[model samples]
Structure formats: structure tokens, C-alpha cells
Target chain A: SQTIHQWPATLVQPVGSPLSLECTVEGTSNPNLYWYRQAAGRGLQLLFYSVGIGQISSEVPQNLSASRPQDRQFILSSKKLLLSDSGFYLCAWSTTLNYGYTFGSGTRLTVV
Target chain B: AQTVTQSQPEMSVQEAETVTLSCTYDTSENNYYLFWYKQPPSRQMILVIRQEAYKQQNATENRFSVNFQKAAKSFSLKISDSQLGDTAMYFCAFLGDSNYQLIWGAGTKLIIKP
Candidate 1:
């Protein structure tokens, strides 16, 4: 079975600080990876998605960015965090087909 | 562009009761997929059910089922024998053949009261 691992389940960052949230999937190769953010008690918004390594398509252009450094590793990063950047970030992966996605546990970010 | 609409922002039902959450979508494509996902306080997304646009039969999983009306562009989820654990946020999502991204609805917060 495939499993997704996300680190720093909860993060507290000061404003203008750098941000890095990592996600990795085991037991799958060449999967489509995606980053989604959910505001407090709100719906999810797609931020970025990647079809393959070094290929990322951004949905909402903001301070956040995603990278697929390896086939199973995906990272969401920001050079400087903003107060608006605080939210719950999720990582998901799917196959080449339009099958549904398998999501990670998510990272809750609070920029104070 | 495809869009999903979940008009219900909140719903409440007594334990062991039944509840239906409504969802509707707009898409120009004939072949696509619709899904209902649950997010509990744990914040983990759990897939409840899915419906394929090409299929005529509605999809069901255990106590969960979907009333899919392709022509009407409606896909409602029915949860029977609801439990307190069912309290969570339910989101309706859509995926068309043209894109891999899932268009999401605003979600309906469902509460199962004891």
C-alpha cells in the first residue's frame, strides 16, 4: 500500500521568515503530486501540481512554491512568509489517469 | 472551466438518522468524475464515494451512496445510520478528462448529534 509522509505537522513561523514543508510518498513512482491550502475551517484551494520531476504548474500565484526534486519527494517552500500564508497545507498524489488523489496528513502553518 | 457547487454550508442530523448533502457541477465535457470526500477534526481527507460520468448506475459504498443525475449535473450523497464520527466537513469535487486537477466545492459542515 502507498503511504504519504508529511513533516512538521504543525508550524509556527514569524512573519517574513522562510518556510519549507516536505512531503514524500512511498510505494509509488512517477505519481502526480499536488499542493493545496485550506483556510481555517474552510475549503481547499489548489496551489501547485507537478506531472514529473522539475515540472510544476502553479494554480494560485502567491508566495509559496512547490518542487518535485525526486519521483516520490515533493517540497513546498517560500522565501518569506506572509500573514496571509498561514493555513493548512496538504500534499496529494495520483496516477497518470484521472483517478482520485491520495492526500497526506497536512501541515498547519501559523504565521504570527 | 469546470466548477462544483455545494450549496449547503452546514447540516446536522441525529445519530442513526439519515441525511443527504446536495452537490451540483458544471462541465462541458461528457466524460468526467465526481467525488465526495470527508474531512474530520483530524484534518485527514477520507474518500467517501465516487461517480463516473459514463456510468449509469449510481455508486454506493456501505452506508454511503450517491444520487447521480448526469443530465441535471447533480450528485448528492446520502449517509445512512449516521454516527457521531461522521461529523466532519464534506466536499464535492470534480475532475474532467481535460485536466488532472480536481475542482472543489466550498464544502458542507455536517454534524452528527448524539
Candidate 2:
């Protein structure tokens, strides 16, 4: 079975601190990766999506960026975090021909 | 641009009752996909049901089913014998074939009383 692994299930970081959240998928190759954030009791906001390595399309222009250095490894980073950057971050992957998405457990980050 | 609208922000129903959540979407493309996802207190998204645009027959899985009206661009989810575990945030999403990225609506919070 295919599985996704995300690190640091929860984090509390101070404002202006650097951030790095990692996500990796196993049992799949060349999967379409995506990063999404959801506000408290709200809907999902698309941040970034990668169709292939070195190719990333950002949906929202904000304090974060995504990098797809490897086929199955995707990393989300921020140089300086803001109080508004706090939310639940999710990682998802899908096959090229398949429209169905498989999402990770998600990371709950709180900026204090 | 494609968009999804979930009119009901919150709804409540007694256990074992049947409830229908409403969803409507706007798109210019003919081929697309509609999905209903469930998020519990744990906040993990679970695919509840999906409707493909090219199909006329509605999709059903166990006690969950969808009323898909392509002409009206409306897709509503009906849960039979609703259980307390059905208490969660339900999100309606649209994915056009041109753009596979999903367009999400402000989720509806469904609370099932025991």
C-alpha cells in the first residue's frame, strides 16, 4: 500500500523564526505533490503544487515556499514565520491520470 | 474560474435520522469531478463520495450517496441512518479536467446528536 510520512505532527514557533516541514511518499513514483493550509474551522487554501521535479506552481503568494528536490520528497519552508502563518498544513499526492488525492495526517503549527 | 459553494455552514440532526447537505458549483468545462470529504475532530480528510461528470447515474457507497444534477451544477450528499460518528466538517470540492487542482468551499459543520 502507498503511504505518506509527515514530520512534527505539531509545532509552536515564535514569530520571525525559520520553518521547515518535510513530507515524503512511498510506493509511488513521479506523483503530483501538493501543499495546503487550513485556517481554524475553515476551508483549505492551496499553497503550492508540483507536477515534476524542479517544477512548482504556487497558488498563493505569501511567506512560504515549496521545493521538490526529489521525486518523492517535498519540503515546505519559510524564511521568517509570521503570526498569521499559523494553521494546519497538509501534504497530498496523486497520480497523473488519477484525479483522486491521498492526503497526509497534517502538521498543526501555532505561531506564538 | 471554477468555484464551489456550500450554503449551509452548520446543520444538526438526531441519530438514525437522514440528512442531506447541499453543494453547488460553477464551471465552464464539461468534464470534471466532484468530491465530498469528511474531516473529523482529528482533522484528517477522508473521501466520503465522488461523482464523475460524464456519468448520469448517482454514486453510492454503503449508507452514503450523492444526488448529482449536472445540468443545475448541483451535487448534494445524503447520509442515511446518520450516526454520531458523522459529526464532522464536510467539504465540497470541484476539480476540472483542465486544471486538476481542487477548488474548495467553506466547509459545512454537521453535528449528529445521540
Give candidates' CA RMSD values in order: 0.8, 0.9
RMSD of 1: 0.8
lDDT of 1 by residue, A23-79 (tens): 999998899999999998789999999999999999988998888889999999999
Please give, as one word, the docking class of candidate 2: medium
* Real contacts recovered, all predictions: 0.59, 0.41
Candidate 2: Cα lDDT at A58: 95
Candidate 2 TM-score, true structure as reference: 0.98
Write one digit per residue (lDDT tens) for candidate 2, span B1-114.
898999999999999999999999999999999999999999988889988999999999999999999999999999999999999999999988878598898999999999
Here the TM-score of candidate 1's chain B is 0.98
Off by over 4 Å in 1: none
Alpha-carbon error at A77 in model 2, in Å? 0.2
Q: lDDT (0-100) at residue B40 of candidate 1? A: 97
Candidate 2's displacement at residue A99, Å, is 3.7
